[model samples]
Target: MKELSLYLMSLLYITAGVNHFVMPKVYLRIMPPYVPFHKTMVFLSGIAEVLLGVGLLFTLTREWAAWGIILLLIVIFPANVEQLKNKKARGKLPLWVVILRLPLQLVLIWWAWLYT
Candidate 1:
C-alpha cells in the first residue's frame, strides 16, 4: 500500500508537470498577480514536479520526495487560500467543499510521510 501510494503520487506529479508545460497559459492565469516572471515560475515548477516525481520512484529518495512534496504543498497553500477566499466572495464553490479541501492537504502530507 505504501508503494502503491508513492507510485500514485509520482504519477500525479508527472501528469501535473506535463500539464504545466502543455497548458502553461491556463496555469499562468491562475498564478497570483504578485508573482513575478509567471512563465518562468511555471516552467521551473513543472521541472521541479517532474524531478520530485522521479525522486519518488526510488526507495532511496522516498523520504526526500516526501519532504519535497510537503514543502511544495506548503508553498502553494497561499494560492489555495486565495482561491478559496475568491470563491467565497463570488459564491462559487460550495463553502463546505472548499473548507473540506483545506484539511485534505494535511492528509496528503501525512500519506507521503507514512511511506517515507
Candidate 2:
C-alpha cells in the first residue's frame, strides 16, 4: 500500500506538472501580481514537479525529492493565496472554498513530509 501510494502521489504530481504546459492559462490566472516572470515561474515549477515526481521513484532520491516537493509547495503557496486577492482568478469558486484550499497546501506538504 505504501508503494502504491507513492506511485499514486507521483502520478498526481506528474499529471499536474504536465497540466502546467497543457493549460498554462489556468496557472497564469492565479499568479500573484508581485511575482515577476509569471511564465518562467510556471515553466520552472512544472519542471521541478516533473523532476521531483520522477525522483520519488528511486531509493537514492526519494527523501530529497520529498523535501524538494515540500519546498515547492511552500514556494507556490502565494499563487494559491492569490485566489483570495484576485477574485477574477477565483473564477466563480466560493470564497469559503478558496479559503479552504489554502490548507490543502499544508496537507500536501505533510504528505510530502511522510516520504521524508
Best by lDDT: 2
Question: Whole-model Cα lDDT per candidate?
Answer: 0.77, 0.92
Top model number, TM-score: 2
- TM-score per candidate, chains pooled: 0.80, 0.94
Pull out the clashing pairs in model 2. Answer: none
Taking the tens digit of each residue's C-alpha lDDT, what string does model 1 give over 1-116? 76687789999888988889998875665566687898998898888888888889987987898789888878766656655667433244677876787888898788767756
**Which TM-score value belongs to model 2?**
0.94
Going through the candidates in the order shown, the clash numbers are 0, 0
lDDT per residue as tens, model 2, 1-116: 88998998899888889899998988899999999999988989998999999999999999999999999999999998998889999987899999998999998899889999
Deviation (Å) of 97 in candidate 2: 3.0
- Tell me how candidate 2 scores on lDDT: 0.92
